[model samples]
Target: MLEIITNNRKKATLKYVRAFLFFSLILLILFMLFITGVVIYAKSKGAPPLAVPQSTLIYASDDSLIGETHYGEKRYWVPLDEISPAVVEATLSIEDRGFYSHHGFDYKRIVGAILADIKARAKVQGASTITQQYARNLFLTHDKTWHRKITEALYTVRLELNYTKEEILEGYLNTIYYGHGAYGIEAAANYYFGKHAKDLTISEAALLAGIPKGPTHYSPKVNEDGAKNRQQLILSAMVENDYLTKPELETISSQELNYTFGSTKERPVIAPYFQDEVKRLLASKLKLDQETINTSGLRVFTTLDPELQSIAEEQITQTIAKDSEIQVGFIAMDQHTGQVKAMVGGRDYTESPFNRVTQAERQPGSTFKPFLYYAALEKGFTPSTLMRSEVTAFTFDDGRERYVPHNFNNYYANDKITLAQAIALSDNVYAVKTHIFLGQDVLVNTAKKLGITSQLASVPSLALGTSTVKVQDMATAYSTIANGGVKQEPLLIEKVLNHKGEVIYESTPVKKQVLKPEEAFVTTHLLTGIFDEKLNNYTRVTGRTVMDQLTRHYAGKTGTTRTDSWMIGYSPQLVSAVWTGYDRDKTIDLTAEKTYAKEIWASFMEKAHEDLPVLPFRAPEGVVAVQVDPDSGLLATKKCSEKARLTYYVKGTEPTESCIGKAEITNEEAPKEADEEEKKGWFKRIWDWF
Candidate 1:
């Protein structure tokens, strides 16, 4: 009976063992099928195209790099050979110890991470290998979720299957964020250490490698202590992984590493304001948002002249009061093409990003007078037209108060002054009277035609330049006069190329004849009168300083209001406008000593025209030069005093009548005049003898 029971027990044990084997075989088959499905799915997805955020490069007219615009990620790709071996070792040691040995994921590290998380009762540890990290960075979101994990695993498998270990490491290093607007190992090394990735020391490489775990917390600029701590851990791991000896690790850890603070130092921007203007222009022309402009990897060729831009920025910095709250805006453009050659939007763009050249609108003051004078010229008024410079008041048809205008310092001659003299003297009363006589609507229309798009009040004050306009528009307006009445829209960008260097868009200046050549020439001549020392007393002419420095034939106007001061002028080749004022609408006293606009304008214009030929303003057909009396609009005669000056007039509009001299003896009474002189001489001789 015992033998039989033992045999049955043995049989039962054998049966249990066979059943266990069968179940194990079924489970293995199921696991194999699951793995096969994952592999197939990942293969179908294929390796994601290696896409990295790229920066748009802006180049000056000389083909020098001016600026770069980036999206959220700022990265620069480099080949695997360019990376330092120390950087590779540090990254592998801290990020994934079993990177070379694992297929896609390290199961031992994964199990250890899971146990650690269970002990901590929170998902505080990450077991993502380098491949998994690259997969997430390239294709998956960073959210902590089972779905994202699965997707990351699938992408990791594909990455491992398609790319070599070196390729995977290269992609991983190039895609990791390193804080402070820096992405990728190359950008990180350059930004923080001011050196290339291939030149990184072991300590620097360790610090950079530690940044990927928590870039913000490990940034050396933000938290040096935390970064040092993480760096020490990375160095220790490097030594433990046989990447460095104990003594070598000690020596590297003891060496001090210097770092640069900002990303701009790594990649310098040559013309920030001009670059911004280009971006804005591109945005409008392409119908794309600013984000796309920054991230599209476009190669923008701008119209900016780097030399002129340097001069502009330097002149503005030197001319503005050091301790004052005043701000200045400047812009220079090519008269023929309307290409913006140089621009300084403000004293410092960092303090105020408001681009006064293209955005801010302030009262143009007397700068708006040229348009008014141009309107008068269009209305058959010549430069010699007589206008009253006395104080004048106008009552508006609308229920507003009466508008009374005064000349600067209440110093008008209160006499009949030729339009040329009025322009040279910037007589406010004369301008207002001319505006009213020619019709206010005419001046407004003329301003709009000249490219002053800012709103202008229809009141008579518009003649006195109470209308607000941008410096860019003012520059364009003067450029129109310089370009022989052809108004070309201001252009900032020359051409835009895609990442592959294909021309995507190019600028063709929008141009139209806004004024007759004769009219524009007459107006330009009148503007030149402002710099005439003889026409003015050489004292109060607003553009006298510019005239003193500039040798070329140019025309300009100086404008001063309670809150703004401007010097907008142009040569036949270049046109520029300089505006100085406070950012807030507070009254600023722009005395001769405080008027930086004219000073800066003179400095920049003189430097800009240094290499160009001295070209005189050519008078177009139908425009004639004639001498005229200062007090009368008529032509000059021998009887007229020396105040008579040469003036330009549109043909048929010149003064036809000659000036009549003061009352005196006529030619018929020449003999009687001689007898009177003889009698006076005899009487004087007798008195002297007595």
Candidate 2:
């Protein structure tokens, strides 16, 4: 029994030893697995993260044409592929030598950096590897703290697991801010080089690469010596990393830095007046918000000809003159295409915010007479139709007042002036008489069809520009006549392209037939004669004195409203409308020997006509120019001094009879009869009898 019990004890001891060994191996394996899992999880969490839809940078075409933008700051981001290899290598060497090899944190480098810091006992230590720094810049704020560092480490691990190395570097390069309001490598390159990131030079690359450490402290523009020293450090790293040979480094170190920084924000300063119009048109057409319209970085291709724009600016500046306090607005367009080539809203863009060209409504004065005359022409009144340019009156139903029409000189010759002669002289009485004969409704309708959308009073005085209209609308009106009766709404932006190079909007020319080509041509011919005619047989009139020295014959009309002066003229190549007035409409001191209105017009025309070929107005298919008596507006005889006239070419359109034979008062008899009648009036007889 004793021997069997001893055998059982021995067996039990052997089994106990075997169980202890197996349990020991199991615990050791579990311990290794836990450490491995922790390391893998930490590294997975360390990867640098990225947010969607990064803020993009926008640029203007040149330094001279910029639209106002309200961005956080202008930044032009360059893609990773476009950046120079040297730029990337140099930045990596200076910032993080172990960037490629490290998962997110480089413990070896961090320890060495800390040791070096302890030895130096100075706060100039940066142990952050390129990957770690990228992680910090991307996910963490700039405030330094142990707690933040711990969080940065966790994020670094996340970044390595989530994103690729190349992506982290890209985000690092793009997201980091360099001082001087720049936020990316691309912006820094442009900010310094006045060129795109793809256009950066080697020296420029190094200069920017050195900015991330201390953007403000070592900015090349602010501290050249500090930048140079920082740059030398980076160059040494590049040499050590085999990015550059020693010889290349030596050569680069000796070269002078020819960096230009303020050149960075080069944006085009385009026509502000046209830009404003574009915004308005886009708002109405595209139904866009102001924020989107202003900052879309949209590539707008306009119909503006650069040459014409320069000419227009020069013309306006010359016309308004540096000394004049008057503001002037002008716009010129192609008669056929309706392309607005040149426009100026005010004398100086910087001085004024008021856009007078498309705004400000003032009575267009005698310039309004053309619409009434055109109505009469369409109503079977030939250019030679007889009209009385004598003092005229009308009694209104309100019993308020009767407006007697008088010429600009406050004198009226009671002669039977032909329709053409009356228009040429811009006689108010003749315009009123013709307007009444045709009816005021006819004139208003004709004017509206000719692109005059301004409100018109339902009275005969409407013929005298009693209705106020803007310069742009007036330009549209005249352009219709110049365009041979097709009304085209003026356009500014031709197309808009988005950041990804997608076209968003393009303009299609919108045209509407507003008048018969024949009517339009007849009006053009009559207005042309007003400029071409020599004052003969009509009373020695005081209106615009005809200057015969001009070699070219073009159609134009001048106007003087209560306080505004205007000139709307057209040649074969361009149509120009000009307005000059004070902001608050004060009657311009016409006492000045030469009123500013005419001088402004003359100056603008002289400059505008310089490059434009002297092309004559093309009369439409059925129109013809013929010579007639300026006084009688009839077929000329040998006795007529002003025998030159332009008559319509249509068959049956010519005046068959001479006004010399038909008129009740010849030029000589009318003035005498008017004086005799005036002598018999109550006030006149009292003065004469006394």
Best-fitting candidate, scored by lDDT: 1
For all predictions, the C-alpha RMSD in Å is: 9.4, 8.1
lDDT of 1 by residue, 478-528 (tens): 999888899999888888876545798988777899889999998888888
lDDT of 2: 0.71
What lDDT is obtained when candidate 1 is compared to the true structure?
0.84
The models' CA-based lDDT, in order, is: 0.84, 0.71
Number of the predicted model whose TM-score against the real structure is largest: 2
Model 2 misplaced regions, further than 4 Å: 1-68, 77-176, 185-187, 237-243, 263-270, 282-284, 294-296, 305-307, 319-324, 396-401, 535-553, 591-594, 637-642, 649-651, 657-690
